[model samples]
Target: MAKPMRRLMNPALFICDLQEKFRPAIYEYPKVIATTQKMLKACKILNIPVFATTQNKSRLGETCEELGLDSPDGISTKVHADKTAFSMWTPEVRKAFADLPPTTPPTAKRECIIVGIESHICVTQTTLDLLREGHKVYVLADGVSSCNREEVPIALARLRAEGAVVTTSESWMYECMGDAGIQEFKEIAKLVKETKDSTQQSLQTLCKI
Candidate 1:
């Protein structure tokens, strides 16, 4: 296996097309949002950079409220990029990276942690593009979904075959934590606890395929 990512301090998170209108079609919408929320909280504690994309927000509506992706001030650690493109590697997203704090190296790019809706389309395209650009992509399977249940498994299988590391939100968070001694361990532990019940019910369905 490849050496696992332990770069939580400056990690990058890509949340794609998790809009309100997109919810009805997504399987296990509640659990996906719950797991994603847990992941986001962990990212905040670790100061992981976040880039969120909304596909045609005019029609799809904004990102769902459960995730707290909206901050009216247009100022927050979570950067929002509005786009019509399927691949979120749009200019806005690129600019988000460019706008990262000086703590981030201008030369080297870290692995991108990906999550969000419609696994077979935008999520898949973005994952492939990032991989093509030599960025290791880790897609959080439990946090990704498709309107057509069958398509998710197919897309995930293809993503894995293409060398994208497929994993669950919990596993990735624990990997990032690396130890129980970290001060943030308590918050992360609580977040993990809250999500386990509902998340497991959905993961059973998502992972079985």
Candidate 2:
């Protein structure tokens, strides 16, 4: 068994195409999006870098409004990548991530935690490409979804075969920060509580109807 201690996660988060058009088709989009938002908040509080991609925003619309992404000017726009491909290698994609300063030491490439829709398409391709680039790729299993549940498991199997670390949103978040006693812990704890409360409320509503 792989030691849980060895399952270190990346501080950088790469949110893929969780757009409005894309979410309704994915089985766990609501849950995944909620977790992704929490993970994003944790990263932000810890001063970790974050990157996101969208698949042709003109066609699909923006990343789901729930993400609360801020513009470069900090206006909080839902649109991010506006790209054609699944991988963040397009001119637009490259420009967005290229400017982010690494969170770790100067020599270390940024670690990327990827979460998004259609595990077999955008999520799968992006994770593979990042792994190829020598960056640590941590796939947030609970935060990625597909229209078909089977596809997600298959994609995860392939990723594990290729040595990608598969993890959950909560696990990855705590690991990235490494401890809950630091001053920042209280801040992240608040975000985590907010996420849990919101998720429970959403689930309760879904059950009521």
Question: Which candidate ranks first by TM-score, i.e. highest?
Answer: 1
- Each prediction's total of clashing residue pairs, residues at least 3 apart in sequence or on different chains, is 0, 0
Q: Specify the highest-lDDT model's number.
A: 1
How much lDDT does candidate 1 score?
Answer: 0.80
lDDT of 2 at 64: 75
Q: Local error of candidate 2 at 50, Å? A: 2.1
Model 2 per-residue lDDT tens digits across residues 87-153 = 7656765666666654345667656788887778888888888788787788877777788877877
Q: Give the residue spans of candidate 2 off by over 4 A.
A: 1-10, 71-79, 197-209
How many pairs of residues in model 1 come into backbone collision?
0
TM-score, each model?
0.87, 0.81
